[model samples]
Target: MSNISVSENEASSSEPENKNSPAVIEESPELQRASSSTVPPDVPSDEPPDAPDGGWPAWSQVVSAHIANMISWGYGTGFSVFQLYYKQTMNLPAVQVSWIGSVQIFLCFLVGVASGRLSDGGHSRQLYATGAIICIFGMFMTSLTNTYWQILLAQGFCQGIGAGLVFMPASASVAVYFKKNRSFAIAASGCGSSSGAILYPAIVQFLMPSVGFPWAVRICGFISIALAIVGFCLLKPRELHRVPAPYLDLKAFKSLPYSLFTAGSFLVYFSLFTILIYINSFAREILGLGDVKSVEFVLVTNAIAIVARPIFGFLADKFLGPVETFGLNCIALGVMAFGWIGVHERIAMYVYSAFVGFVNGGAQGLFTSAISSFVPDVRKMGTWIGMTLGLCGFATLAGPPTMGAIVDANGGKYLWAQVWAGSTIIIGGTMVLISSRLVLRDSAKPSAI
Candidate 1:
């Protein structure tokens, strides 16, 4: 007993040195002292360093991520204002105008593959700075555009490409700063994006009358540039020594949960974006509302999002887990979309829009956390998140136009379009449900292969 006591004392005395020592590579990824044991081969370990989850350093990263999201996706969602303006003034068919937003979203997703992979390789800051400059340049150019083609090239291609570059890195920056409260952290980070979505419409709706279109757009650009500079000055990657990873690691899909989640994400984005794009048209045509009323509808929806996203994340972290929460949210959103078919009166439509925004907004931000939950290796999270987003970008590209075409073919009735959106979202939810169950099973295992 004395020998055992002395040995324990000696080991305890050496514990500080063990904490200070460099992480040793184990032959097996099976048994780990890190948070989870599902890490794959080729990575050194699941955790290189413990995340400083609550310090100013960690929360500051969350703030930086919020700024990044505000500049990219928050501004992107504001494209509803542009869509409304173009539809009213362009005289082009809705289908043709829809292509502009589609291309913009498509490029945003498409660039994720390269940008996300590079972010994993320790290039996050550089990529974000470059992307910010490009986006600012694109916005300024958009302010100068008079022709449709010019808008497409400047706003759609350039802005979209720039957003794609910054978004995944922004999401990944927060992932490295927290573990236990990861879902809430990522969800809280989305607050800026939702706020941006709300603020932008007000910016456009108020500015266009007082400052005119060109200056209003330029002001929006200025806001984006200012916020981006703040983010660039402060944002940091916690794991400074993250090893570079492959842009397209097909091996990741071998896990059925990951693959199933990807498919679910594709369908979710595909169906989700359609409602956002058409809300203005739905208000003006179906409800006998005017331009201002339509803009208000968009504003109300996004405003609800500002509050909903973090709540979703909190629930995910506290009770449901990210995957299960995401699946449930998807199902809820599907039900809400179908409910849209029943709303026709002005008051009812307003309420419906708010609820829809609440559900969709939370769902949008939830996926970032959900996808992160599946990636055991935090170092490669950017790669995995970017790849999934890149693939889902195709759905975003096709969804708005596909729904628009359906509306056009159906004599401008939204019944079929709503039906399609609701069904697609429900199907996506089921896929996520399957993924959540699969992941729960894998986590129950004593050892991961």
Candidate 2:
């Protein structure tokens, strides 16, 4: 006991000298002591290094940031040009040719769930680069293919993979970057698709006659390379303390409002792409318009949609809630689908295009906003969105071929397909409308009551 007490006293006395001694210093002991210490770091006061603040990206920054996405969407419009190729060049039956576009659209969105997860994991840039490279390769490969199967593999699968990589990340990034004006930001992101829908077809038409399909496709491939470059340079994610989100969270879909909204999204996209894929062909053959006029009709709708998306998004945020706006737009789209039943002349086609573009644009912007509302927990949104989009991807895959089959069964007249599409729009619109009403009712109820 006397020896133990004397040893303790000697150890305590040596502790101060050991801490002060530099010659016999060891890192682990000092680290252990530092961990137990309550005092903070004794460093000079200065502004800490941090990521650049993104306070509502400037107009030029906004456009520059979004341009690459727009070009990607524009690249998708190349499928519309395929309508002309199938009908005029390949001389394939409408039903058979429709599969190419349907498969492409299906694959693009189908892969979005996986891509969304990748983005959440801090690998978006690599995923995007890989997609662009694959898509460019597919485009060049498409120019060389003659058979339907070859084109499907190269254009549909490979190109579709590229598109899938770009879509969700590009869209979700808008939500991440802009909170104050989220609707407008989403609308801006959407411009890429709209521009792609319009410009690609028009450009292809101008070049296909003179340069031939192969060279035209190659030109588009080169353009995609440029697009990918810009995207890598400018499309940066803002650094934030992100809680890792599940890539596929099914439980979030249990919310009734979100379920209904997702159902409506599936219906809308199914019908939307069906019309987009078939409209140019319908305008040319069924409506008896010239090829140039038919393409112009398609172009006009996409161009108008660019403006309408931003305008309606603003209205949804400012006046109506996202649910209300989605319902209204769905209703308008139904009306436009019905109007298509009577469209034959160029003038009527133009009117129909403008109406459909306006309504569809609004619906798209509203749906993105509404989905986020239901899954208010930020960390869970990516996973919830992935599941919903997966469902939507399945629908997009089936819609075009199914519509084309209807046209074929009806002796190459699109009237049957048109009626089916119109009915679908009405049903989807009603679902969204009922859901919106329920949301409004809930919001209006007084807490005291």
Q: Which has the greatest TM-score?
A: 1
Residue 166 lDDT, candidate 2, scale 0-100? 69
Clash count for each candidate, listed in order shown: 0, 2
Please identify model 1 stretches exceeding 4 Å from their true place.
1-45, 445-449
**Candidate 2, residue 351: CA error in Å?**
2.0
Worst 10 residues of 1 by lDDT: 28-37
Clashing pairs in 1: none
- Report RMSD (Å) for each prediction in the order shown: 7.1, 15.7
Per-model TM-score on C-alpha atoms: 0.89, 0.83
TM-score quality measure for candidate 1: 0.89
Error of 2 at 368 (Å): 2.5
